[model samples]
Target: MSKKTVELSFPKLVLIIATTVFSFTSMSNAFYLMSYAAMPWYIVAGLLFFVPYALIVSEFTGNLGQYSGGLYSWIDHSLSQKAAFLTTFLWYSSYTIWLASLFMKLWIPLSILSFGQDLTTRTASFWHIPQIYWLGLGSCILVLIVVFLINKGFFTISRFMLLGGSLIALLFVVMAVSNLILLVNHHGQLSQPMQQHILLNSPNRDYQGLLGNLGFFIFGITAFGGLDTVASLVDRVGHNKRRFPFAILIAAILITVTYLAGIFLWGASANWAAIFTNQKVSLGNAMYFLMFNLGHQLGGVLGLSSAGTLILSQIFLRLTGLVLFWAYIGLIMTIAYAPLKSIITGTPKNFWPHFLTKENKQGIASHAVLGQGLLIIGLIWLVVFSNAHAVNLYNNLTLMTNVSRSIPYLIVAIAFIQFRKQQHDYQLIAPRYANLASGLVITTILSAISFSIILPLFKAHYLESMLLLIGPMIFSIIAVILYHHFNRQIELS
Candidate 1:
């Protein structure tokens, strides 16, 4: 450690890590989980999956903080390089699924901005073909443009991310204040009153079963999935050995509280009965719909005319759309190349095609980005065109995303246990009991994955459940294929 090396203060590290966790999380997850498991499942998942995973990541911070490749660097050092590649491959693939899904979801906000409500179903198709396929094709074209324009980069993205972060903060604050007012003005009456029994059980009858909507609980866990992104920043923290891990632990707890509060605050305005009875609110447009209702109800609480309330609702809806569109456009581009770059640069040059590995003065690998973008477009076509219904496609994509994202954590958790044992001593957490913290997290995630797979079968979503089980198998097969291909290339070279 050099005295000249600049280091972040504890408070600054907390702020940075908190922002990272929040960036990884989503208000939409709160609404999705609220529809089923609500707060109880949130608490359970937070303790078992969320916090312990943070502990595992924090353990990585002190050891692998010097490396910038995040999970790839950490796992490569602690485990085999091939093991690292496989872990990051799963992570990148999960995120790519999310990227492909966003093409369809971006329509939700576009619909809200154009009309007063979601019109995704109408816009999903034109000339008897899904528009998402067209957008996916367009996305591939844009990636080629990006490949050509990589050096002169289109525009700086920091400003977009800053603006997006601000909008998210404001969105939560506005919701919290409006819901708080409603709670008081309504004389301590909740629109959806919480009963002890209902809080612990699945609230939506459609999702109720012995396993109790395990998918949503896993969805809640997915919100905690991006600790690796935060792990990348440990190098900047002042006391890398101590402060960074503590900051992550603190950020994890704070994020859990925020999500739990957001879920609870929603009940002040959104009645579960009304939303459930009206089966129209699928997972697709639920957030926009709920936020629109929040604005409308808040306008009513302010003693506005029906017309004024409608106008306010429309304004709010459009604003949500604009912000989401702005945020995700930049975010998608960021994730698209960022993860690919990490994976490509972290490994030996022969592991990828030379053209793909070749970087110009701009530090851009054009072919690799194009290759990934082409793959994403293909996946988008398969998912968007395969689903018969717009809502069902979005639901499948979102759930598939949950399963995709969850596997990375399972890989890391199991790896972290091994990573920590090689350490002479543990810092903030003990490694004895075979690193029990990660063990608990690993068990919880595997259970969620297992139950999420088998339970949905009884409900007759046979294909969806089947995918949840086989999704990892598919990813693992791809990882194996890539590994062998690269290994053969190395041998020949």
Candidate 2:
């Protein structure tokens, strides 16, 4: 094999896709998934949504390498350009909301790194406003700094991603092994015993019934939804037809297995009841807490002094916080540039102005990158100054973004079915595989939507649901307006 092929070997390619889609930082999702303690639904969602999503993405990206426009090109070739425009817009809209949510929340890691805990809650406000005002300003500054570094190009900034990925991956590995040691010492007892009932139902007394369980199922679906972002990384794999699919399949299996194992492993050291009962252990900080608590328990296992155990735990939190801080740097840099680039390249040239689509010396879309940063800053302040509480608004944006991200994959899966049908080559995805992928995607998404309406009723998540409904309408309206305006621009030219 060539040096490039050897470097991007089967295992390394799998690791890249797995890490990209299911990062060490993504463990926050584990807490959410286990809150229901509904492992079966999570498993079901993985099979239906995640594995198939990975398969089709592998097929499209691996087989259709000639298309420069990623997701947009796939859809445009298989479906109509109008459908491609609308679908890509919806997909990019999710990232925009994500950028908005990401900036304000990025401070939590910075605060933890500096102070050994999140300080945003303790932040003093200007005037009568909440702490979000100051945090928003800080995040805007952070965004500017990240944007400056990203403008230098991906390779220049990716060193931070490498460092953060390695550190956090090692940390989570330590976490799993430490908990395994804990389980071994405890005579193989789970920290939170797996009740037979929780397999079929939510363990939380606060939510019980059809709506509650269905809501939990929907939540599981969302938890597994981020794998769509891994499509772009497939190009980096060697032997596109052979290695790419193998890599994706392995990544898909590993992601599902790891998530399932992580959910159970949390029980090795954490009593879900005790941890969830603590006011300090909210969803945002659960990943840190996992490391924090693991360090303390492992210290106890290794026979340390009280002060020594405290010190060890503090180190874990600080290390994770530091890793997460750098991870956010890489994250913001990519989210700011990659999605915008994909939308620009994936769509028709006429869909965007030359200035916005232009690349600078680094071949970076500097204008779009800068413009995205400015929009993110504006969104930060918008959330800060909103009549709704900042926390509520953040939750709303997160919920909408998760839902929005799923829609694009469903569209792509449809397009993939079309793309496969027209293919004369048998080496690509077989007709049977394409149909199976479409069937799974359609079924999973439809059920997720139909049942998701019940989630607010059980969870008291009315605001999030309202925004989830409204967010798409707004995105569609904006897409329609922009489509018409750009068509007019093309006509005028």
Candidate 3:
């Protein structure tokens, strides 16, 4: 008799892929980035970009069935090899810069955990240097550890993603409850409708400010992607056609709700100006502070001793800090592994040089891992040592990462259009014209938004802006040049 098939349930599949795709931390950060103004944009982007993008991916994955390299595979099959290389390069670089941002963010939880501060301090001593420097140092250590683990073949991406995703889900619940307590304390009620706070009063209509918000909008869009990372595992799901779409739809809804909750809770006590005061605190750090205070409040309410409140809050805060740090490591690990594997595995042999093609005994891409790690380390150093203020530097990196990351999505849309055009035998999931039209419209809108955001950098930020705009393109160009050169050499030899 044939062995009974074992399949992952829809819920289990969602757990595996959710963290690798959407991050609550990023969604919450974007919530605070645009303050209440993010609400309308979220709705707008959700309809115009997010939902359509997900549909496009689902259609592509369904049609491509059992052939998976995620984005790289999708593009490579539909477009020229050079286009595939460039798309994958931009995709990979997006996460790499994002890794730098996360590295710098390590100090946030550390300062909160060790020093009990809401605002990240630049002055505290760690090995005789500033506290921020230690954070940078810690980031370097994390990169080294990740490289070592991947090279040693001890690393697993989905396990970390599942663990981290589960904790983030728990964190959301904790945050909601704690924020409720704080809300009751301040407002004398817990039943106030959150929708009232959704629309900002006198929203900023200026071009430059709106342009900056475009970056945050793009960040929100990024929170919805990378779901296709789990395409290879689609067949393992019990019902791919029914389950996968339901899972992603539910994930999108949950993310949207969480963003609203966070924005309303925080905005209940502070104006947009106050919320935007420091890019350093971040939504996660703010949640820590709320948790700390809520611990004390709950202890008193529960009739625990005064000392118990202090101890409980301290313990809770420390635990939160540790969990957050570990989650960052998990996320960066997945980021480091996923795109690199996708790009290399999907590309032709001659496209990448032998050095990058080398793998360890366990099939881990050792050389590629090292190269990615070194790039991240250099990026961290540049940001940490830059003359720009920490907040500006971090924000700029985020915007750059958002821009780079969205490029692949745009390419994916274009590729879908091309694929549908070339394959007349393909059954229509939706109408081909509707799909193609929406994809083009979404890509064009996103491009316009990105261009508007990058335009002012030429005048205001000058050099930093230039790097942010040109850096990924330059890297992609270099990759293309090397690919051609290698092909030429092979032909001669």
Q: Which candidate is the best by lDDT?
A: 2
- Tell me the spans in candidate 2 whose CA falls farther than 4 Å from its real position: 1-12, 23-36, 125-132, 233-243, 385-402, 424-429, 457-464
Candidate 2 residue-wise lDDT, 59-135, digit = tens: 77666644545677778888988888888788888888788777777788888878898878775767987676777
Superposed Cα deviation of residue 432, candidate 2 (Å): 2.3
Ranking by lDDT: 2, 1, 3
Better of 1 and 2 by TM-score: 2
- Per-residue CA lDDT of model 3 for 372-463, tens digit only, reads 89988988777666657855766665655555666677778788777776653334355645466456546654665456457657459676
Can you tell me which runs of candidate 1 are displaced by over 4 Å? 1-37, 123-159, 229-247, 381-404, 424-426, 460-462
Per TM-score, the best of the predicted structures is: 2
TM-score of each: 0.83, 0.89, 0.78
263-333: candidate 1 lDDT, tens digit per residue: 88888888877765566766666767777888888899999999999888888778777767655655655
Better of 1 and 3 by lDDT: 1
For model 2, which pairs clash? none
> In terms of TM-score, how similar is model 3 to the real structure?
0.78
